[model samples]
Target chain A: MTEKNCREEIIFAGFGGQGVILLGKLMATAAMKAGYEVTYIPSYGAEVRGGTANCSVIIDNEPIASPLVTEPDTLIVMNQASFDKFVPKIKPRGLLVMNTSLIETPPDRDDIEVMGVAADEIAHQLKSPRSANMIALGVYLKKRGLLTPQQVAESLPYVLAKRHHDMLDVNTRALMHGG
Target chain B: MSEKILITGNEALAEAAIRAGLEAYFGYPITPQNEITEYMARRMPEEGRVFVQSESELAAINMVFGGAATGKRVMTSSSSPGISLMQEGISYLSGAELPAVVVNIMRGGPGLGNIAPSQSDYFQATRGGGHGDYRTIVLAPSTVQEMADLMFPAFDLADLYRIVVMVLGDGVLGQMMEPVLLEKKQTHRKLPAKDWALTGCAGRSQNIVKSLDLVVPRLEKRNLMLQEKYRRIEENEVMCEGHLLEDAEIVLVAYGIASRVVRTVVSRARKEQIKAGWIRPVTLWPFPSRQIAAAAERARLFLTVELSYGQMFDDVRIAVAGKAPVHFTGRAGGAIPTVEAVLDEVKKLMQPGKVAVER
Candidate 1:
């Protein structure tokens, strides 16, 4: 794990409505709650819903400078297109976490760490495909060690809508299952 | 110390305004800035404050004008196109010498541009986007924390100068979430007694709050008065931050989101043994000319990084006054310049043979 004060920039990219933005927000909120300066910027455009949507999240001990991540330290890709688009942009020796259910072929990058989780499969096992993002995030938190699973779970109430509160247990289970 | 909360810039601004005792909020929904209006709509009514979703930006700015004329802390927010629609009312507010805060979460420009972030509205914001010989105090906040913190000072400065104060930001700043410490509710020390406000004359002489001074001489006098107030604000209200400039050979000038990118560039440049510094303008209308000039005295080069195609570059050139070379690198229509690009520009400027002073 990197020392405190070092910046970690991550990109959570997928097709829209895959909870990419929500996952980024959740990670940012958890990092902030753990006393790290954090920034989360969502990719916004006319084609936001069904198009390729990605968000950049940066967490550091010092104040963050830029919210846009050009070469992220970690890339969490939930779809094949997101994997193909963002895989090449990850820093050498960075972490690449992909949803294996959607991305069958692994990236050919030997310089970085790769973690493949069947996030959608796990979410389906949990009877909620929408919880796939949580599963991927669980793998990210477990691998990166930048944030604790406890911190991410504690932040669920803040990021999730109030009406979805009943699904906190399911999401938590999905997160733990993937981790 | 207050607990740090994760929030977007628009949400922070709305929360800050509520804490600042915002009396009324009148705004139309616009992308990138719609969150501000939404947050206000949800919170303002609960506070028993006035929040009106005007049918159009024109109506919203006019509502702001009416609210501010009554001596209440009022605000309106919108993106580029919507802000353009409100310019006339802004000019009226300025001409009437009414204090108001307007937040422009700038998006891509020209006409009906995309919802991505851009600083193309720099000229419109700093140069009195509306017609008239009046200036609005502009504060460009780069961080979500500043987005919250500056609202209090923005309202105070607007009230103090009796001018429209703009909190100019971009869509990136508006949409990005960050940790911010919400300042405790403030009690202003000396709020000006708005004696000029038209609160209806019970026994005193009737007060009129009108921007129309049709007579040429009176209009000329009013313009001069407004100029004097602007001059005073220019003298007292210029705010900027200098980072790692004590022994810098090059200084990067930027504001809002661009400045945030410059910080990273400066740090990276320093790692490569380049003496790069940055001057971030917190208040844009006052322009921070003196700080840039002071930096020019020592730094061999000045680079202006913006989200516009050289809009603020003109100001940088004017401020440098040819004492040192002034260079520009930017992207318009919502493209954010990357750290590598800015660092490359810095390295190019640092080359011994590449330095050329702008005439």
Candidate 2:
């Protein structure tokens, strides 16, 4: 991480109510804490409710340019709509992490690596379905080996609102469960 | 304060303004900039400051005008359509010589443009956007970090000059989240006392802050004084950044979010052995003409990239002054100019006789 000027472009996408934004924010905060230059750009246009929600997170060793990412190096999709829309935009030989419980259709590309995590199922076992995004986030971080699940777990208190801190225990458990 | 925090550009600028001793915050709802007002609404009251979500953009600017006269730091923010509504008030702020901050997190324009980021406000911001012999100082921030970094000075420059200072950013710069050290400025301009401020006369003569002057001769003298201030600002307040410019043949010129992409273009072009550089105007009012003019002496060609169709391009052309060919590549209506588009333009201009500077 210190030697190479690595730039990873990841897009996390799901339905609006899926908390995909908080998922990206956790990754961004953890990456920032680990001393990487990062940017998290969320696209919430006029129709923010019940629409397809997406955020682009770029973590790099060097200062990032063009916060907008046209083609992502990694794609994390929670629902089938996101998978259908963003699966084509992933760079060749890139990685795809999708929530397998909801997405029945497999990816069309063979060049990219795909991993399906039962994020919703894992999160439901902990009685916190809302933390499904966290579980999916943990899977990506665990596979990447660059940042740890603990890094994101620790960032929860800082990122989540004070009123929502009660869910910390369940969210952390889901993150570790996915790992 | 030196520790970095991941924050959105809109919140960062609002926080920066709050840390800059902003006494009053006034705003109305608009996208790409809602975060600034939202953050201020949440935090300003907690910090024991004044925060007003005014009735409208007009009301917000009038609130700024009223707050500015009291010799305290005040600010208002809006997007393109809302900002257009506040132009008459902005002109009044300029005419009254009020030291206040205005943030325009611009979006696509000409009518109710989309909420997606656009630099179409370049002309509106730089040209003062209102009828009068006045121009507000405009600072264009290229990144979220710059959004914070420029806020401190935006207020400082406003107070130092007794003029309206606009923090001009597009929706991308406003909405994007990045790591930034939102720190307070330690030093400031050794400003003269606010004797002209309408702080209510106690031991001295009453100070009146207004744009109204019925007497023709007095109005002319006041206008002349304002023009003199503008001249001083041009001489002393012009700020710009040059990148890889030494001995470069092709100059890339942009401001705000457009410059962020153009920077990527220039750096990528460098890898391909293109002698490209960038002239980014941090202060757009004092349009960095001197810097662009200097680049023209050595560069064979110049390209002005923007979100609008050559708003800043006109300024770059004027600055180049026929010393070199100035070309433009841009998009309008919420469309952002990408890195590839700009590189293609650069390569096209690099060819022999695509166009040449007019003698």
Candidate 3:
């Protein structure tokens, strides 16, 4: 009872087609299923196809206030551009999850814990390049221990469209493998 | 208990409208609000309701006017520029005493501006955007859950008063997703009959609905009747929420997404022993002025935070009536105010001998 309920603010950023928004949505759905108050807001603009896309997600035991995350507790970047843009904004000693295959250089910060996962390489090995985001998500969940693999697996149908249900098995494998 | 699902604010509004037994949805696609039209297009036809993506915003609003004239639950949604374009038809609906709901997922304004969240439309939405003397019931939803919950009451209020109602939100609220337990389709609530509907005059006398009157006295009488109805609305339906106001020294007045930011500020300020409170106006038109006045009696100062350049600050000043010093902090042209920026403003306001006067 002495421990206050923790609030986790996360930002997922990548190229538009990298499924960054969907990754945030999946995390938000899983968080909601786990009985936490959650909010997900995606970066929207006219150049959504090839442009950079990001989303902020807040999962708290208490009711969430603002959906905008100015400084995030976790930074998940799939590309170098996103890393450069958002790495400075992470809270000190925060968790930084990056796609090592894309960002060759690591951040210079000594305070934060940086977890570099070869997400794209793993997805390529699995023959499912689109599942890179799932791999990254799996890494974040494992590091944070906010949600279990089973919880995310169960919430897949809620976030994924019906036509893409066939990919759930690969997504789950990628998630568990990354974890 | 109903099942909870993650839904964006725009999608929540569309789903709630369908559950509220919406008969028709007519709207053109616009940024931040296009999701509503897309959702309605997908679901309305499946549910055997009429859904149309009109050629333009002007045509869409007229379609709402036509559908509402037949006493059907009709609605249309848009962003700031699109809503501005629909003002003429909105005026007609208000003058004709037709019941309709218009959802404005407001974006940066004046012109096409940008497709970003903004509350700059405060004056436009609350003070009557269209011509002539008229008032529309404005409901400002701060959460995705409220985005769904308010639609039922919005449609109900419109029908009860025989006037147009607006659900005012911004792009941030429209795009953000949260868990919500949507109420079941409203079948139990009693709805007043649309006896003035322009149905065929088969067994009864013809019912004519028109806003134009050639005579001056008749127009004046219509204006006076509308004013009386607005007064009744103000008396019965002023809704707001006061948070941490019991022992507060500073009260922050905000609505919609800005209110959400203010809530965070209040919490952070409390930890630092700053007795900051917040008042969120749920209904912007009726404007819960009494609540603000009461808070002024207890609080030493008042502040207003908005996504616009002090648009809602005027209303806050009016409510405080110079009883307490009122300050304003805001961002316009599609920028959102950060927590640090707002907290800095609050800290400055708490400084000694720096008072704010009404603008």
> Highest lDDT, which number?
3
Clashes of 2: 0
lDDT of 2 at B278: 92
Candidate lDDT values, in order: 0.90, 0.88, 0.91
What's each prediction's TM-score?
0.96, 0.96, 0.97
1 against 2, candidate with superior lDDT: 1
TM-score of the first chain of model 1: 0.94
When only chain A is evaluated, what TM-score does every model earn? 0.94, 0.95, 0.95
Error of 3 at B342 (Å): 1.0
Tell me how far the alpha carbon of residue B174 in candidate 1 is from the true structure, in angstroms, after superposition. 0.3
How many clashes in each structure?
0, 0, 0
Residue A72 local lDDT, model 2: 94
A1-179 per-residue lDDT for model 2 (tens digits)? 57696889999999998988888898899989998999998885664657899999999999887777888999999999889999999999999999998999899899999999998888888789888898888888888877878878999998888999999998888878754
Off by over 4 Å in 2: B352-359
Candidate ordering by lDDT (highest first) = 3, 1, 2
lDDT of 3 by residue, B1-359 (tens): 58899999999999999998799999999999989999999999999999999999999999999999999999999999999999999999999999999999999977999999999999999998999999999999999999998998899998999989999999999999999898854634577899999888899998999999999999999999999999999998898999999999999889999999999999999998899999999999988989999999999998899999998788888888989988899998899998889998888888778665543
DockQ of 3: 0.82
Give the CAPRI rating of model 1: medium
- Which candidate should be chosen as best, given TM-score against the real structure? 3
Pairs of residues at least 3 apart in sequence or in different chains that clash in candidate 3: none
